[model samples]
Target: MSSQRSSKTFLQLKYGEALDTAATKKSITSLLSSHDGTEVIHHCLKEGARWGMSPDSEEPNTLEAVYILSGKLKLHRPNEGSFLEAGDFLAGQPVSEFIVLTALEDSEFLYITSNPVFHYYSSDTRNLEMLAIEIEKKDGYTADHCFRIKELSMLVGEKMELNSESLQKLHFGALLHDIGKTEVPESILLKPAKLDEEEWTIMKEHTRYGATILRKTNITHFILAAEVVEQHHERYDGSGYPKGLRRDEICLEAAIVGLVDSYDAMTSERIYSKARSKESALTEIKQLRGIKYHPEVVDYFLSVIE
Candidate 1:
């Protein structure tokens, strides 16, 4: 297992390579490009002082560790803005109102927390390694499934011209949509044949289970991600469940996830059924477009596979 210190060093090295320029007018946007992997674990970045203010509604209880790598920043809490210089390290129980503002010169900082207020990024190597370990532990196939679905979903999202931020959410959401299945019964999940009605009902609960699990993280992105997990099983015509949300009732991110998830399920070999050829799966998806899946999403997937 990687130690916290090693993880921090890895993050620092990655961040440096992406944001080392000293002369340019650096903003949160520039900083984010270097810290893309970490974004899934954190929420939005505040650029300069223009809009990087913290939430003021309620005080947070989790702890946050901030390590400054370069330049300077004014840390604003409810009462004051404290100036923090490079090489400074601060740790505090989460405050309801806390924000960071970068100085005119380029600045860098690392934010770490166990609470789920932001997104965490994992590179392909990390994701694959984690999946391998999960498989070794005999957890299930969900992790491996997530990895492929994320790749396919991103491909479709890019072809559809989704903005960078939305694309990132879609990618992470796909990986996590079935995370709730962790609460499901292993026998039902790995059954070699079809599920009985009772088993099917239990299986369906995975969505709600996933959402609930993510909600405990207290991260805003996971909140959005939770919604995706809850609604990924919902159908366009209002026949799907937990909630039978219809049409635009479902979030766009959830819809993207739903489409890719279905595609993967149909195309991949499972314990219950043999995998369909990609062509056959595409044909089925095309036939169900608009009724079962979003038409635009279907079109994008087709374009990519073609």
Candidate 2:
């Protein structure tokens, strides 16, 4: 008998030839199918492992989805490549009619394809309850802060009549604008004394650092959020950095974040500074309206606070 048939027969006899093989197979398939459509995929690919078609390989036109379950994978194209980590998703065309994948670690992934041309058996959500757990694991403080900022940003963004998509972006951007601060030195970040000029300079780099960190991820949807991080410190008249974007030169999203960020900073107690009264904070923001902040943004913030 053929080897495949012999193997099947062995399983059948072992489990009992009288048993329903089809039902057994169905149950197994159902268990494996549990990964379908979710970010977590179940396949183990170890580090330094390499697989791909040759340079002249005729690639198939297919819709592919990859989700990293654990560890990492480096997907290489002719001119570009990326490292994907757990929870990252990539849905795009293969590069140069060929592609290569190298595991960066012992990684698990869920890979799905619709093309019958290349047969390689190598691959890889949950509701809010699951999402909360996921976000907590990812970045707990930032996730919670973002949820609050999104609500506030939405109120301001909607008043501006931003399109639904732009409003959504603004909401998300506000929440993520300070995410880069994660990389800053904890001593500097939590310092109770005034930062020296050198310390201040280092602190300012958080914006650029934030943008760079997010740039390395597959979360292109957060690009605007990254930009907001980079520009939130910029002033209306001109004095901001890493870029001194002025007036309309700055993204509106950045302007919104700056306004709200200042409000939050003033109202929240810091080691170096006691929290100001709400009325005092509002007065200070109003004083800086046309000089340090965009007039329209200041107006909207004032309306919200009132």
Best by lDDT: 1
Candidate 2 residue lDDT tens string, 1-306 = 111111000000111112233122100001133233222224555554332321111333434556677887666543456678999976644322333455667666665543322111211001221233233224313323444454466567655645433543464456556656667677677676788999888888978986776555423234434677688889999988878889999988788888887777777654456778999998998999989999998898778778
Runs in model 2 with CA error above 4 Å? 1-146
Error of 2 at 265 (Å): 0.8
State how far residue 170 of model 1 sits from its true place (Å): 1.3
Provide the overall lDDT of each model, using Cα atoms, as 2-decimal numbers.
0.57, 0.54
Candidate 2 residue 163 Cα shift, in angstroms, is 1.4
Deviation from truth (RMSD, Å), model 1: 11.5
Error of 1 at 211 (Å): 0.8
Off by over 4 Å in 1: 1-143
Q: Residue 263's C-alpha lDDT in candidate 2? A: 79
Q: Which ten contiguous residues of candidate 2 have the minimum total lDDT? A: 5-14
Question: Per-residue lDDT for 68 in model 1?
Answer: 69
